[model samples]
Target: MTLQFSATALFAHHGGFGINVNPFETNLINLIIVIGVLVWFLRGFLGGMLERRRQAILADLSDAEDRLTRATAELTRAQGDLAAAQQKAETIRRDGVARAAAVREESEKRTIEEMARLKEDAVADLNAEAARVSDLLRREAARQAIEKALASLPKKLDAAAQSRLIDQSIRNLGNA
Candidate 1:
């Protein structure tokens, strides 16, 4: 068999398969051999197409492997980020707790101070009231004593008589 692409007009209108079947067309062995060659050629063409499909499938697999690697790395990064976020949240929670406790303690301290201030004010008011009452009582007692002394003054006596009365009262008190 000789290679002859030029002799075979690719698109002849007659579509004769480019074969001269005048004599060999009637020979049984020659016909069988021609059929075998056609089958062999068809198989070669189909096999090449199958090989290209297999190569394309292998390329798709390689691309899928690369995508899987990138996806795994992204998942690892996402997990790390999640852990960091959790730690940050915990820190915030602790800070919030501390701030709340501080606020409560400050509020308690302020409440205690206000209570102490109110108590002091009440005690001061009570002391002032007691002082005013004692002063009023003292004034009343002094007025009564002055009135009694004034009323007895006229009946007491002159200065020399009062002096002698005072000395006699002292001697009588010493003897008792």
Candidate 2:
């Protein structure tokens, strides 16, 4: 290529300063000309490639920022949901405790009532048993007294007294 030939010519002509202060030497001028031409030819291509790369990087950065925002919103929403769930759990626990207490109180009341009813029934049963025992004792005493009276009355009676008692019984029957 022409660029390779020019670069080779410029290098081949390179020489020492040898106390010469001239900056426009043949090799330096040739090198400058070659560099200037290469820049002019490649500027548009390199610039366009760099610009596309920069746009892609910007797009990637924008996408990353959007993802970060969405993630932040999701995290906040999750935190709120957690808080609500905790509150709900606490409410359920409180309700359960209240219900348990109420049930316990009700159970205690029922137990007390049952005990009272049983005690009343027991007292009534004892009273009924006492009454029955008293009635039995009274009947036994009356029967014993009647038996004793019947046993002694006959031994205490005489023949004259029996005859008089027979005469009186016959008179009472005639009056009736």
Write candidate 2's Cα lDDT for 63-126 as tens digits.
9999999999999999999999999999999999999999999999999999999999999999
lDDT of each: 0.80, 0.80
TM match of model 2 to true structure? 0.68
Tens digit of lDDT per residue, candidate 1, span 61-140? 99999999999999999999999999999999999999999999999999999999999999999999999999989878
Cα deviation of 78 in candidate 2 (Å)?
Answer: 0.8
> Candidate 1: RMSD over Cα atoms?
8.8
Error of 2 at 169 (Å): 19
